[model samples]
Target: MKKKDSNTIAQNRKAIHDYTILETVEAGMVLQGTEIKSIRNGRINLKDGFATIRNGEAYLHNVHISPYEQGNIFNHDPLRARKLLMKKKQIHSLIGETKNAGITLIPLKIYIKNGFAKVLIGVAKGKKQYDKREDLKRKDINREVERALKNR
Candidate 1:
C-alpha cells in the first residue's frame, strides 16, 4: 500500500492576526461536485470564512469556491453555505464555547488530505487592538535582532 500526501488548497492568513487561536480540529466538508472541482483548481478563498453551529450541525459560511465554468446550470453557488461533518457532541461543545463573549469558530484553512477535502477550523478569541500592536512590536524586534546577527 502507498501513503497519500496531503495538499493544502487555501489558507486564511487574516485569521491568524485577528484571533488568538485556542484549538484546531479537522472536519469533513459536504461539497458538491462542481464546488470540489473549483477547489481543486485553487479557486477557493477562506479569508472571510467562519463556522457556525445551528440545529445540531455545523455549517461553513463566507467560503467562496468559484463556479466551475464548464457546468452550465449545474454549477453550485460560489458563496453558498456548506455543511461540516462532525460528531454531534463536538458540535454541541463548539456551540457552548462560542456562546461565551469574544470567542468564535473560524475557518483556518482548507486542504486535501489523502484525496479528501478537509477543513481546519479553530476555536479562537478575538485579539484586541493593543494585542495586535504588541505582536507587531515583537515581530519587528525579532527581525532587527536577526539582521544584526546576520551582519556580524
Candidate 2:
C-alpha cells in the first residue's frame, strides 16, 4: 500500500477571525507555467484575498503568486486577478447569495489536490462589534471549563 500525501499549502487565518464563514467551496485555478512553478515552491499568499462574481463568472483578486525565480519575462503577474473554474449553476448560486447585503466571498486557503491547484473559498458575513466580543467571551468560558476539567 502507498501512503497518500497531504495537500495543503497556505491558509488565511485572518478570514476566520474577521468573518463568520457560512459555506465553503473548492474551486480550480487557471495558472500559467511559471505561476504553477511558484505555487509548488510555496510562494503564494491568500490572506487579504477575495472573490468576485463578474459577468456571471467568479474571479479571485489580491491573491499573490510570486514569480518563479528561474523564469524569464514570461512569469505571471504576482497580483493579477485569476479566474476560478466552477460550474455555471454553482456560480449563479454564489452570485445570488452574494447579492444579499453584507455577504462576501473570501479565500480561505490554497492547496494542491489531485495534481492541480485548488482554492478553498468561503461564503461569509462580516461580524459586528458585539458579535466579536461575544465570541471572545465564549472562548474564554470554554477555556476555563477545559482547564477545570484537566485539574480535577
Candidate 3:
C-alpha cells in the first residue's frame, strides 16, 4: 500500500500496473451541487475511471462521487461524466498525442488543492502482460533491497 497525502481523496492504483504513464497534467473538475461536499468527505472512487478528449474538450468518464447523505434532491448523479477544465493549448496538445495508436488519457488520482478538486491525469499507453510481470519483479527487488538495508 502507498501512503497518501493529507489531501488525496482517491487513487487508481491499477492505472500504474496496467498503463505506462508518459506524462501527468493537473486539471480541475467542473462539479455540480453536492459533488464537492462528497469529495471533501472522501466519498470518491477512481477505480475504472478514465479521461478523454472529445469535440475539442476534455471530459472525465466513469468516476464515482457518491451522493451526499444530506443533499436530498440536490445530490448529483454518482457516475455522471464530468467536464474537465483545461487550457485550450493543453487540449490541443493532448489531441495530437492521443492520435497515436494505443495512447490514452487516464486519471491517476484526485485531490484537494487550494480548496478545489483537482485530478492528476496521466498520458499513458497500455502495458503488455510481460511488462506487468517485469514491474512486479522490479517491485520485489526494490522491497528486498530496502529490507536488507534496514537490517544492516
lDDT of 3 by residue, 1-152 (tens): 56779999888999999999999999999999999999999899998898988898999999999999999887899999999999999999999999999999999999999999999999999999999999999999999999999999
- Cα TM-score of candidate 1: 0.90
Candidate 3 off by > 4 Å: none
TM-score of 2: 0.91
lDDT of 2 at 136: 87
- Winner on lDDT between 2 and 3 is 3
TM-score ranking of the models = 3, 2, 1
- Model 3 earns a TM-score of 0.96
lDDT by residue for model 1 over 9-38, one digit each (tens)?
Answer: 888889999999998989999999788888
lDDT for each candidate structure: 0.90, 0.90, 0.95
How many backbone overlaps does candidate 3 show?
A: 0
Candidate 1: minimum summed lDDT over ten consecutive residues — where?
1-10
What are the per-model numbers of colliding residue pairs?
A: 0, 0, 0
Which is the winner by TM-score between candidate 1 and candidate 3? 3
Error of 2 at 96 (Å): 0.9
- Judged by whole-model lDDT over C-alpha atoms, candidate 2 comes out at 0.90
Model 2 misses residue 94 by how many Å?
A: 0.4
Give TM per candidate. Answer: 0.90, 0.91, 0.96
Tens digits of per-residue lDDT, candidate 2, 4-115, equal: 3467788898898899999999999988768988988899998879999999889999998899999998888899999999999889889889999999999998889889
